[model samples]
Target: MSRPAVLAARLRTAAWLGWQIEANWADPFTFIVYSAVRPLATALILAVMYRAVAGIASSGQAFLGFYVANAFHEYVIRVLVGMGWVIVEEREEFETLKFVYTSPIGMFTYLWGRSSVKFVQASLSLLLILTTGWLILGLRWDWGAVRWLPLLLSFVLGLIAIVYFGFFVAGWALVLPRAAISVNEGVAAALTLLCGVIFPIDLLPRAVQVVAMLLPFTWWYEALRRFLIGHGASARLSSFSDGALLAALAVSTALFSCVSVWGYGVLERRARQNGKLDQARLF
Candidate 1:
Protein backbone atom coordinates (compact mmCIF):
# COMPACT_ATOMS: atom_id res chain seq x y z
CA MET A 1 0.00 0.00 0.00
CA SER A 2 1.01 3.59 -0.54
CA ARG A 3 2.01 5.64 2.51
CA PRO A 4 -1.23 7.60 2.59
CA ALA A 5 -3.27 4.42 2.07
CA VAL A 6 -1.45 2.67 4.91
CA LEU A 7 -2.03 5.60 7.23
CA ALA A 8 -5.70 5.67 6.28
CA ALA A 9 -6.05 1.96 6.99
CA ARG A 10 -4.49 2.35 10.41
CA LEU A 11 -6.72 5.30 11.28
CA ARG A 12 -9.82 3.33 10.26
CA THR A 13 -8.78 0.46 12.49
CA ALA A 14 -8.05 2.84 15.34
CA ALA A 15 -11.44 4.44 14.96
CA TRP A 16 -13.13 1.05 15.10
CA LEU A 17 -11.14 0.25 18.19
CA GLY A 18 -12.25 3.50 19.79
CA TRP A 19 -15.92 2.83 18.98
CA GLN A 20 -15.73 -0.66 20.40
CA ILE A 21 -14.15 0.66 23.60
CA GLU A 22 -17.24 2.75 24.30
CA ALA A 23 -19.93 0.48 22.79
CA ASN A 24 -18.71 -2.65 24.54
CA TRP A 25 -18.92 -0.88 27.88
CA ALA A 26 -22.55 0.24 27.53
CA ASP A 27 -25.54 0.06 25.28
CA PRO A 28 -26.32 3.08 23.07
CA PHE A 29 -29.32 4.03 25.19
CA THR A 30 -27.35 3.81 28.39
CA PHE A 31 -24.48 5.80 26.94
CA ILE A 32 -26.76 8.55 25.73
CA VAL A 33 -28.61 8.72 29.04
CA TYR A 34 -25.45 8.85 31.09
CA SER A 35 -23.81 11.46 28.92
CA ALA A 36 -26.81 13.75 29.00
CA VAL A 37 -27.67 13.27 32.65
CA ARG A 38 -24.17 13.60 34.13
CA PRO A 39 -23.34 16.95 32.56
CA LEU A 40 -26.79 18.39 33.23
CA ALA A 41 -26.57 17.39 36.86
CA THR A 42 -23.16 19.01 37.15
CA ALA A 43 -24.44 22.15 35.50
CA LEU A 44 -27.28 22.36 37.99
CA ILE A 45 -24.87 22.18 40.86
CA LEU A 46 -22.74 24.89 39.29
CA ALA A 47 -25.80 27.07 38.70
CA VAL A 48 -26.84 26.79 42.32
CA MET A 49 -23.37 27.65 43.52
CA TYR A 50 -23.18 30.65 41.24
CA ARG A 51 -26.55 31.92 42.36
CA ALA A 52 -25.59 31.58 46.00
CA VAL A 53 -22.26 33.34 45.66
CA ALA A 54 -23.23 35.99 43.16
CA GLY A 55 -26.72 36.56 44.65
CA ILE A 56 -28.14 36.46 41.17
CA ALA A 57 -31.78 35.39 40.88
CA SER A 58 -32.41 32.18 39.04
CA SER A 59 -34.94 33.99 36.91
CA GLY A 60 -32.36 36.47 35.64
CA GLN A 61 -32.15 35.74 31.97
CA ALA A 62 -28.80 37.43 31.57
CA PHE A 63 -27.09 35.38 34.25
CA LEU A 64 -28.75 32.21 32.98
CA GLY A 65 -27.49 32.85 29.48
CA PHE A 66 -23.97 33.50 30.69
CA TYR A 67 -23.99 30.45 32.95
CA VAL A 68 -25.20 28.14 30.22
CA ALA A 69 -22.61 29.38 27.80
CA ASN A 70 -19.89 28.91 30.41
CA ALA A 71 -21.22 25.48 31.27
CA PHE A 72 -21.04 24.49 27.62
CA HIS A 73 -17.43 25.60 27.52
CA GLU A 74 -16.78 23.62 30.70
CA TYR A 75 -18.13 20.55 28.94
CA VAL A 76 -15.48 20.99 26.30
CA ILE A 77 -12.79 20.89 29.00
CA ARG A 78 -14.34 17.76 30.49
CA VAL A 79 -14.24 16.01 27.15
CA LEU A 80 -10.64 17.00 26.55
CA VAL A 81 -9.46 15.71 29.94
CA GLY A 82 -11.53 12.52 29.70
CA MET A 83 -10.15 11.65 26.28
CA GLY A 84 -6.61 12.37 27.46
CA TRP A 85 -7.02 10.09 30.49
CA VAL A 86 -8.26 7.20 28.40
CA ILE A 87 -4.67 6.28 27.69
CA VAL A 88 -4.03 5.86 31.40
CA GLU A 89 -7.22 3.84 31.79
CA GLU A 90 -6.29 1.51 28.95
CA ARG A 91 -2.87 0.91 30.37
CA GLU A 92 -3.79 0.48 34.03
CA GLU A 93 -7.29 -0.96 34.00
CA PHE A 94 -7.74 -2.69 30.66
CA GLU A 95 -4.14 -3.96 30.60
CA THR A 96 -3.96 -3.30 26.86
CA LEU A 97 -0.92 -1.08 26.75
CA LYS A 98 1.46 -3.89 25.80
CA PHE A 99 -0.77 -5.10 23.01
CA VAL A 100 -1.34 -1.61 21.73
CA TYR A 101 2.34 -0.78 21.86
CA THR A 102 3.11 -3.88 19.84
CA SER A 103 0.44 -3.18 17.25
CA PRO A 104 1.29 -1.89 13.80
CA ILE A 105 -0.93 1.14 14.32
CA GLY A 106 1.15 3.82 15.95
CA MET A 107 0.25 5.29 19.31
CA PHE A 108 -0.30 8.75 17.79
CA THR A 109 -2.73 7.46 15.16
CA TYR A 110 -4.61 5.35 17.71
CA LEU A 111 -5.01 8.29 20.06
CA TRP A 112 -6.01 10.62 17.22
CA GLY A 113 -8.79 8.26 16.19
CA ARG A 114 -9.94 7.72 19.77
CA SER A 115 -10.05 11.47 20.48
CA SER A 116 -12.11 11.99 17.32
CA VAL A 117 -14.72 9.63 18.79
CA LYS A 118 -14.58 11.66 22.00
CA PHE A 119 -15.11 14.91 20.05
CA VAL A 120 -18.30 13.55 18.49
CA GLN A 121 -19.54 12.27 21.80
CA ALA A 122 -18.77 15.62 23.45
CA SER A 123 -20.56 17.52 20.67
CA LEU A 124 -23.71 15.48 21.26
CA SER A 125 -23.48 16.13 24.98
CA LEU A 126 -23.14 19.86 24.29
CA LEU A 127 -26.41 19.86 22.32
CA LEU A 128 -28.28 17.95 24.99
CA ILE A 129 -26.95 20.21 27.73
CA LEU A 130 -27.90 23.31 25.79
CA THR A 131 -31.41 21.97 25.25
CA THR A 132 -31.81 21.05 28.89
CA GLY A 133 -30.58 24.46 29.98
CA TRP A 134 -33.00 26.19 27.64
CA LEU A 135 -36.01 24.19 28.80
CA ILE A 136 -35.27 23.83 32.49
CA LEU A 137 -33.14 26.82 33.44
CA GLY A 138 -34.66 29.36 31.03
CA LEU A 139 -31.35 30.07 29.38
CA ARG A 140 -32.20 32.08 26.29
CA TRP A 141 -30.23 32.68 23.13
CA ASP A 142 -31.08 34.08 19.74
CA TRP A 143 -29.64 31.11 17.91
CA GLY A 144 -30.90 32.32 14.56
CA ALA A 145 -29.05 35.59 15.03
CA VAL A 146 -25.68 33.92 15.52
CA ARG A 147 -22.92 34.58 12.98
CA TRP A 148 -22.64 31.11 11.54
CA LEU A 149 -19.35 31.50 9.70
CA PRO A 150 -17.30 32.81 12.61
CA LEU A 151 -19.05 30.53 15.08
CA LEU A 152 -18.31 27.47 12.97
CA LEU A 153 -14.73 28.56 12.38
CA SER A 154 -14.10 29.16 16.06
CA PHE A 155 -15.62 25.82 17.04
CA VAL A 156 -13.58 23.88 14.49
CA LEU A 157 -10.32 25.58 15.46
CA GLY A 158 -11.08 25.28 19.17
CA LEU A 159 -11.89 21.61 18.84
CA ILE A 160 -8.67 20.90 16.98
CA ALA A 161 -6.62 22.91 19.49
CA ILE A 162 -8.19 21.10 22.44
CA VAL A 163 -7.71 17.65 20.93
CA TYR A 164 -4.04 18.33 20.45
CA PHE A 165 -3.84 19.52 24.04
CA GLY A 166 -5.36 16.20 25.11
CA PHE A 167 -2.82 14.28 23.05
CA PHE A 168 -0.04 16.29 24.72
CA VAL A 169 -1.31 15.22 28.13
CA ALA A 170 -1.73 11.62 26.99
CA GLY A 171 2.02 11.46 26.57
CA TRP A 172 2.31 11.79 30.36
CA ALA A 173 0.26 8.61 30.75
CA LEU A 174 3.03 6.69 29.07
CA VAL A 175 5.84 8.07 31.19
CA LEU A 176 4.10 8.79 34.47
CA PRO A 177 0.92 6.77 34.74
CA ARG A 178 0.48 7.37 38.44
CA ALA A 179 0.40 11.13 38.02
CA ALA A 180 -1.75 11.18 34.92
CA ILE A 181 -5.08 11.59 36.66
CA SER A 182 -3.90 14.33 39.00
CA VAL A 183 -2.13 16.11 36.17
CA ASN A 184 -5.18 15.89 33.96
CA GLU A 185 -7.43 17.25 36.69
CA GLY A 186 -5.05 20.07 37.44
CA VAL A 187 -4.82 21.04 33.81
CA ALA A 188 -8.61 20.96 33.45
CA ALA A 189 -9.11 23.09 36.51
CA ALA A 190 -6.48 25.58 35.38
CA LEU A 191 -8.01 25.86 31.95
CA THR A 192 -11.51 26.23 33.38
CA LEU A 193 -10.46 29.01 35.73
CA LEU A 194 -8.15 30.78 33.32
CA CYS A 195 -10.10 30.45 30.06
CA GLY A 196 -13.18 32.22 31.36
CA VAL A 197 -15.30 29.09 31.35
CA ILE A 198 -17.48 30.26 34.20
CA PHE A 199 -16.75 34.03 34.23
CA PRO A 200 -15.03 36.77 32.35
CA ILE A 201 -11.23 36.61 32.37
CA ASP A 202 -11.11 40.18 33.56
CA LEU A 203 -12.80 39.10 36.77
CA LEU A 204 -9.67 37.17 37.62
CA PRO A 205 -6.54 38.85 38.96
CA ARG A 206 -4.53 40.82 36.45
CA ALA A 207 -1.61 38.38 36.70
CA VAL A 208 -3.94 35.48 36.15
CA GLN A 209 -5.50 37.29 33.19
CA VAL A 210 -2.05 37.64 31.68
CA VAL A 211 -1.42 33.93 32.18
CA ALA A 212 -4.81 33.17 30.64
CA MET A 213 -3.92 35.10 27.54
CA LEU A 214 -0.93 32.83 27.05
CA LEU A 215 -3.19 29.80 26.81
CA PRO A 216 -4.88 28.86 23.53
CA PHE A 217 -8.19 27.91 25.10
CA THR A 218 -8.54 31.51 26.35
CA TRP A 219 -8.57 32.83 22.82
CA TRP A 220 -10.71 29.94 21.63
CA TYR A 221 -13.33 30.53 24.31
CA GLU A 222 -13.18 34.28 23.74
CA ALA A 223 -13.67 33.81 20.02
CA LEU A 224 -16.48 31.33 20.64
CA ARG A 225 -18.34 33.61 23.02
CA ARG A 226 -17.85 36.54 20.72
CA PHE A 227 -19.20 34.69 17.72
CA LEU A 228 -21.94 32.75 19.48
CA ILE A 229 -23.32 35.29 21.91
CA GLY A 230 -22.07 38.59 20.41
CA HIS A 231 -19.13 40.91 20.91
CA GLY A 232 -20.39 41.88 24.34
CA ALA A 233 -19.90 38.33 25.61
CA SER A 234 -16.16 38.73 25.14
CA ALA A 235 -15.71 42.47 24.86
CA ARG A 236 -13.63 42.61 28.02
CA LEU A 237 -10.78 40.85 26.28
CA SER A 238 -10.36 43.53 23.65
CA SER A 239 -6.65 42.80 23.39
CA PHE A 240 -7.34 39.82 21.12
CA SER A 241 -8.51 40.62 17.63
CA ASP A 242 -10.11 37.97 15.41
CA GLY A 243 -6.98 37.61 13.31
CA ALA A 244 -4.81 37.34 16.40
CA LEU A 245 -7.08 34.68 17.87
CA LEU A 246 -6.90 32.61 14.71
CA ALA A 247 -3.14 32.91 14.64
CA ALA A 248 -2.96 31.87 18.29
CA LEU A 249 -5.08 28.81 17.54
CA ALA A 250 -2.81 27.85 14.67
CA VAL A 251 0.35 28.28 16.75
CA SER A 252 -1.13 26.39 19.68
CA THR A 253 -2.16 23.52 17.43
CA ALA A 254 1.32 23.26 15.96
CA LEU A 255 3.06 23.48 19.34
CA PHE A 256 0.91 20.88 21.05
CA SER A 257 1.12 18.49 18.11
CA CYS A 258 4.91 18.70 18.07
CA VAL A 259 5.13 18.23 21.84
CA SER A 260 2.77 15.25 21.87
CA VAL A 261 4.61 13.53 19.02
CA TRP A 262 8.03 14.10 20.56
CA GLY A 263 6.99 13.18 24.07
CA TYR A 264 5.19 10.03 22.98
CA GLY A 265 8.13 8.96 20.86
CA VAL A 266 10.53 9.41 23.77
CA LEU A 267 8.34 7.48 26.20
CA GLU A 268 7.63 4.69 23.74
CA ARG A 269 11.31 4.22 22.98
CA ARG A 270 12.17 4.12 26.66
CA ALA A 271 9.39 1.65 27.39
CA ARG A 272 10.49 -0.66 24.59
CA GLN A 273 14.16 -0.48 25.50
CA ASN A 274 13.52 -1.17 29.19
CA GLY A 275 10.70 -3.69 28.62
CA LYS A 276 8.48 -1.56 30.86
CA LEU A 277 5.43 -1.22 28.67
CA ASP A 278 3.29 -3.01 31.22
CA GLN A 279 5.23 -2.00 34.29
CA ALA A 280 3.51 0.49 36.59
CA ARG A 281 5.76 3.23 37.91
CA LEU A 282 5.39 6.66 39.47
CA PHE A 283 8.22 8.27 37.52
Candidate 2:
Protein backbone atom coordinates (compact mmCIF):
# COMPACT_ATOMS: atom_id res chain seq x y z
CA MET A 1 0.00 0.00 0.00
CA SER A 2 1.01 3.60 -0.52
CA ARG A 3 1.97 5.51 2.62
CA PRO A 4 -1.32 7.37 2.93
CA ALA A 5 -3.24 4.23 2.11
CA VAL A 6 -1.33 2.29 4.74
CA LEU A 7 -2.03 4.87 7.38
CA ALA A 8 -5.67 4.93 6.37
CA ALA A 9 -5.88 1.18 6.62
CA ARG A 10 -4.33 1.20 10.06
CA LEU A 11 -6.68 3.94 11.22
CA ARG A 12 -9.68 2.15 9.79
CA THR A 13 -8.69 -1.07 11.48
CA ALA A 14 -8.22 0.80 14.75
CA ALA A 15 -11.62 2.48 14.50
CA TRP A 16 -13.32 -0.83 13.87
CA LEU A 17 -11.61 -2.26 16.92
CA GLY A 18 -12.71 0.73 18.90
CA TRP A 19 -16.30 0.11 17.94
CA GLN A 20 -16.03 -3.47 19.07
CA ILE A 21 -14.76 -2.45 22.49
CA GLU A 22 -17.47 0.16 22.83
CA ALA A 23 -20.08 -2.39 21.97
CA ASN A 24 -18.75 -4.75 24.60
CA TRP A 25 -19.38 -2.23 27.35
CA ALA A 26 -21.82 0.23 25.88
CA ASP A 27 -22.91 2.45 28.73
CA PRO A 28 -22.43 6.17 28.34
CA PHE A 29 -23.24 6.92 31.96
CA THR A 30 -20.64 4.40 33.11
CA PHE A 31 -18.01 5.94 30.89
CA ILE A 32 -18.82 9.46 32.06
CA VAL A 33 -18.75 8.51 35.74
CA TYR A 34 -15.45 6.72 35.37
CA SER A 35 -13.80 9.55 33.44
CA ALA A 36 -14.97 12.39 35.68
CA VAL A 37 -13.15 11.51 38.87
CA ARG A 38 -9.62 12.34 37.74
CA PRO A 39 -10.48 15.69 36.17
CA LEU A 40 -12.46 16.65 39.26
CA ALA A 41 -9.50 15.89 41.45
CA THR A 42 -7.31 17.89 39.13
CA ALA A 43 -9.61 20.88 39.42
CA LEU A 44 -9.42 20.80 43.18
CA ILE A 45 -5.67 20.62 43.06
CA LEU A 46 -5.58 23.52 40.63
CA ALA A 47 -7.57 25.64 43.06
CA VAL A 48 -5.08 24.93 45.82
CA MET A 49 -2.02 25.66 43.70
CA TYR A 50 -3.40 28.91 42.31
CA ARG A 51 -4.16 30.01 45.87
CA ALA A 52 -0.55 29.39 46.81
CA VAL A 53 0.74 31.46 43.88
CA ALA A 54 -1.66 34.36 44.54
CA GLY A 55 -1.72 37.53 42.42
CA ILE A 56 -0.40 35.84 39.26
CA ALA A 57 -2.19 37.02 36.13
CA SER A 58 -2.22 34.99 32.90
CA SER A 59 -0.10 32.43 34.66
CA GLY A 60 -3.23 31.14 36.37
CA GLN A 61 -4.84 30.45 33.07
CA ALA A 62 -1.55 29.25 31.75
CA PHE A 63 -1.35 26.75 34.57
CA LEU A 64 -4.94 25.68 34.07
CA GLY A 65 -4.46 25.53 30.32
CA PHE A 66 -1.34 23.45 30.68
CA TYR A 67 -3.14 21.09 33.05
CA VAL A 68 -5.98 20.62 30.60
CA ALA A 69 -3.55 20.19 27.74
CA ASN A 70 -1.59 17.59 29.65
CA ALA A 71 -4.81 15.84 30.58
CA PHE A 72 -5.72 15.72 26.92
CA HIS A 73 -2.32 14.42 25.83
CA GLU A 74 -2.20 11.87 28.64
CA TYR A 75 -5.57 10.38 27.64
CA VAL A 76 -4.05 9.25 24.35
CA ILE A 77 -0.87 7.91 25.90
CA ARG A 78 -2.72 6.02 28.62
CA VAL A 79 -4.95 4.39 26.03
CA LEU A 80 -1.94 3.28 24.07
CA VAL A 81 -0.27 1.85 27.16
CA GLY A 82 -3.49 0.42 28.61
CA MET A 83 -4.08 -1.69 25.52
CA GLY A 84 -0.74 -3.42 26.04
CA TRP A 85 -1.62 -3.91 29.68
CA VAL A 86 -4.80 -5.71 28.66
CA ILE A 87 -2.97 -8.15 26.42
CA VAL A 88 -0.23 -8.87 28.94
CA GLU A 89 -2.69 -9.25 31.76
CA GLU A 90 -4.79 -11.65 29.74
CA ARG A 91 -1.76 -13.76 28.83
CA GLU A 92 -0.89 -14.21 32.46
CA GLU A 93 -4.44 -14.78 33.63
CA PHE A 94 -5.81 -17.25 31.08
CA GLU A 95 -2.95 -19.52 30.05
CA THR A 96 -3.84 -18.77 26.42
CA LEU A 97 -0.39 -17.64 25.38
CA LYS A 98 -0.30 -20.56 22.98
CA PHE A 99 -3.46 -19.43 21.28
CA VAL A 100 -2.14 -15.92 20.82
CA TYR A 101 1.03 -17.32 19.26
CA THR A 102 -0.90 -19.41 16.74
CA SER A 103 -3.52 -16.80 15.88
CA PRO A 104 -3.60 -15.99 12.17
CA ILE A 105 -3.96 -12.24 12.54
CA GLY A 106 -0.69 -10.46 13.14
CA MET A 107 -0.09 -9.46 16.77
CA PHE A 108 0.46 -5.87 15.72
CA THR A 109 -3.01 -5.69 14.21
CA TYR A 110 -4.51 -6.96 17.43
CA LEU A 111 -2.56 -4.46 19.48
CA TRP A 112 -3.40 -1.66 17.05
CA GLY A 113 -7.07 -2.38 17.53
CA ARG A 114 -6.76 -2.43 21.29
CA SER A 115 -4.84 0.83 21.36
CA SER A 116 -7.17 2.43 18.85
CA VAL A 117 -10.19 1.53 20.95
CA LYS A 118 -8.70 3.13 24.01
CA PHE A 119 -7.74 6.24 22.04
CA VAL A 120 -11.32 6.69 20.86
CA GLN A 121 -12.77 6.28 24.34
CA ALA A 122 -10.21 8.63 25.81
CA SER A 123 -10.85 11.18 23.05
CA LEU A 124 -14.46 11.31 24.10
CA SER A 125 -13.47 11.84 27.72
CA LEU A 126 -11.07 14.61 26.70
CA LEU A 127 -13.80 16.40 24.78
CA LEU A 128 -15.88 16.51 27.91
CA ILE A 129 -12.95 17.69 30.01
CA LEU A 130 -12.00 20.46 27.58
CA THR A 131 -15.57 21.61 27.36
CA THR A 132 -15.77 21.82 31.14
CA GLY A 133 -12.56 23.82 31.23
CA TRP A 134 -13.95 26.23 28.69
CA LEU A 135 -17.28 26.74 30.38
CA ILE A 136 -16.32 26.68 34.05
CA LEU A 137 -12.69 27.75 34.20
CA GLY A 138 -13.24 30.45 31.54
CA LEU A 139 -10.72 29.12 29.03
CA ARG A 140 -11.27 31.17 25.92
CA TRP A 141 -10.96 29.55 22.52
CA ASP A 142 -9.89 32.86 21.07
CA TRP A 143 -7.23 31.70 18.63
CA GLY A 144 -7.83 32.03 14.92
CA ALA A 145 -9.28 28.76 13.69
CA VAL A 146 -6.74 28.30 10.92
CA ARG A 147 -3.82 29.07 13.20
CA TRP A 148 -4.81 26.34 15.63
CA LEU A 149 -4.94 23.62 13.00
CA PRO A 150 -1.20 23.07 12.91
CA LEU A 151 -1.05 22.75 16.67
CA LEU A 152 -3.88 20.24 16.62
CA LEU A 153 -2.11 18.24 13.93
CA SER A 154 1.10 18.40 15.89
CA PHE A 155 -0.69 17.22 19.02
CA VAL A 156 -2.14 14.23 17.19
CA LEU A 157 1.22 13.40 15.67
CA GLY A 158 2.76 13.59 19.12
CA LEU A 159 0.15 11.06 20.22
CA ILE A 160 1.22 8.74 17.42
CA ALA A 161 4.71 8.84 18.87
CA ILE A 162 3.33 8.12 22.33
CA VAL A 163 1.37 5.09 21.15
CA TYR A 164 4.48 3.68 19.54
CA PHE A 165 6.33 4.16 22.78
CA GLY A 166 3.61 2.14 24.50
CA PHE A 167 4.06 -0.66 22.02
CA PHE A 168 7.79 -0.58 22.62
CA VAL A 169 7.18 -0.99 26.33
CA ALA A 170 4.62 -3.73 25.77
CA GLY A 171 7.39 -5.69 24.09
CA TRP A 172 9.36 -5.37 27.31
CA ALA A 173 6.36 -6.56 29.33
CA LEU A 174 6.49 -9.94 27.65
CA VAL A 175 9.92 -10.74 29.08
CA LEU A 176 10.12 -8.51 32.11
CA PRO A 177 6.96 -8.09 34.14
CA ARG A 178 8.13 -6.37 37.34
CA ALA A 179 10.27 -3.86 35.52
CA ALA A 180 7.58 -2.94 32.96
CA ILE A 181 5.07 -1.12 35.19
CA SER A 182 7.84 0.67 37.07
CA VAL A 183 9.36 1.86 33.83
CA ASN A 184 5.97 2.87 32.46
CA GLU A 185 4.89 4.93 35.49
CA GLY A 186 8.35 6.43 35.90
CA VAL A 187 8.45 7.63 32.32
CA ALA A 188 4.89 8.95 32.43
CA ALA A 189 5.51 11.01 35.58
CA ALA A 190 8.86 12.24 34.34
CA LEU A 191 7.39 13.32 31.01
CA THR A 192 4.53 15.14 32.72
CA LEU A 193 6.97 16.97 34.98
CA LEU A 194 9.38 17.74 32.16
CA CYS A 195 6.69 18.92 29.75
CA GLY A 196 5.56 21.82 31.91
CA VAL A 197 2.18 20.28 32.49
CA ILE A 198 1.76 21.94 35.87
CA PHE A 199 4.19 24.86 35.44
CA PRO A 200 6.58 26.25 32.86
CA ILE A 201 9.84 24.34 32.71
CA ASP A 202 11.93 27.52 32.54
CA LEU A 203 11.32 28.19 36.25
CA LEU A 204 13.13 24.97 37.07
CA PRO A 205 16.85 24.32 37.27
CA ARG A 206 18.56 25.09 33.94
CA ALA A 207 19.76 21.50 33.60
CA VAL A 208 16.23 20.12 33.93
CA GLN A 209 14.94 22.52 31.30
CA VAL A 210 17.55 21.29 28.83
CA VAL A 211 16.49 17.68 29.42
CA ALA A 212 12.81 18.64 28.91
CA MET A 213 13.68 20.03 25.48
CA LEU A 214 14.65 16.55 24.33
CA LEU A 215 11.19 15.04 24.96
CA PRO A 216 8.28 14.88 22.50
CA PHE A 217 5.98 16.21 25.23
CA THR A 218 7.68 19.61 25.29
CA TRP A 219 6.81 19.99 21.61
CA TRP A 220 3.25 18.90 22.21
CA TYR A 221 2.64 21.44 25.02
CA GLU A 222 4.58 24.19 23.25
CA ALA A 223 2.35 23.76 20.21
CA LEU A 224 -0.76 24.13 22.37
CA ARG A 225 0.68 27.06 24.29
CA ARG A 226 1.51 28.86 21.06
CA PHE A 227 -2.03 28.35 19.84
CA LEU A 228 -3.51 29.64 23.09
CA ILE A 229 -1.09 32.51 23.70
CA GLY A 230 -0.57 33.55 20.09
CA HIS A 231 2.84 34.79 18.86
CA GLY A 232 4.47 36.52 21.82
CA ALA A 233 7.22 36.46 24.45
CA SER A 234 5.53 33.37 25.88
CA ALA A 235 6.40 31.45 22.77
CA ARG A 236 10.04 31.17 23.73
CA LEU A 237 10.95 27.96 21.93
CA SER A 238 12.03 28.32 18.31
CA SER A 239 10.59 26.39 15.37
CA PHE A 240 13.84 24.41 15.26
CA SER A 241 13.74 23.55 18.96
CA ASP A 242 10.07 22.59 19.33
CA GLY A 243 8.91 21.71 15.82
CA ALA A 244 12.06 19.91 14.75
CA LEU A 245 12.24 17.86 17.93
CA LEU A 246 8.59 16.78 17.68
CA ALA A 247 9.13 15.64 14.10
CA ALA A 248 12.21 13.72 15.09
CA LEU A 249 10.37 12.08 17.99
CA ALA A 250 7.52 11.05 15.70
CA VAL A 251 9.98 9.46 13.26
CA SER A 252 11.86 7.75 16.04
CA THR A 253 8.68 6.37 17.59
CA ALA A 254 7.38 5.01 14.29
CA LEU A 255 10.66 3.21 13.66
CA PHE A 256 10.71 1.79 17.19
CA SER A 257 7.09 0.59 17.00
CA CYS A 258 7.86 -1.27 13.78
CA VAL A 259 10.89 -2.91 15.36
CA SER A 260 8.97 -3.85 18.50
CA VAL A 261 6.18 -5.40 16.45
CA TRP A 262 8.71 -7.50 14.54
CA GLY A 263 10.34 -8.60 17.78
CA TYR A 264 6.98 -9.60 19.31
CA GLY A 265 6.19 -11.66 16.24
CA VAL A 266 9.46 -13.52 16.57
CA LEU A 267 8.99 -14.14 20.26
CA GLU A 268 5.47 -15.46 19.73
CA ARG A 269 6.56 -17.78 16.92
CA ARG A 270 9.51 -19.10 18.87
CA ALA A 271 7.44 -19.61 21.97
CA ARG A 272 4.89 -21.58 19.99
CA GLN A 273 7.52 -23.76 18.40
CA ASN A 274 9.22 -24.50 21.70
CA GLY A 275 6.08 -25.40 23.70
CA LYS A 276 6.45 -22.21 25.74
CA LEU A 277 3.42 -20.52 24.18
CA ASP A 278 1.31 -21.44 27.19
CA GLN A 279 3.72 -19.52 29.32
CA ALA A 280 2.87 -16.36 27.46
CA ARG A 281 -0.86 -16.98 27.03
CA LEU A 282 -3.36 -14.16 27.29
CA PHE A 283 -5.39 -14.59 30.43
Q: Pick the candidate with the highest TM-score.
A: 1
Model 1: colliding residue pairs:
none
Clashes of each: 0, 9
Per-model TM-score, in order, reads 0.85, 0.72
Off by over 4 Å in 2: 1-30, 53-59, 94-97, 143-146, 228-283
Candidate 2 structure quality by residue, lDDT tens digits, 1-283: 7876775676576568556644456786765555565655565466456656654442355555565665565454456567556455546755554464466445566566667767766776677666666676665556454366666776676776666666655655555544556555666677767767666777768898777766666666666665555431123454445456456556645665576567666655554555543454332
Q: Pick the candidate with the highest lDDT.
A: 1
lDDT of all predictions? 0.70, 0.59
Runs in model 1 lying further than 4 Å from the true structure: 25-33, 58-71, 232-235, 263-276, 281-283
Which pairs clash in model 2?
90-282, 90-283, 91-281, 91-282, 91-283, 94-283, 96-281, 97-280, 97-281
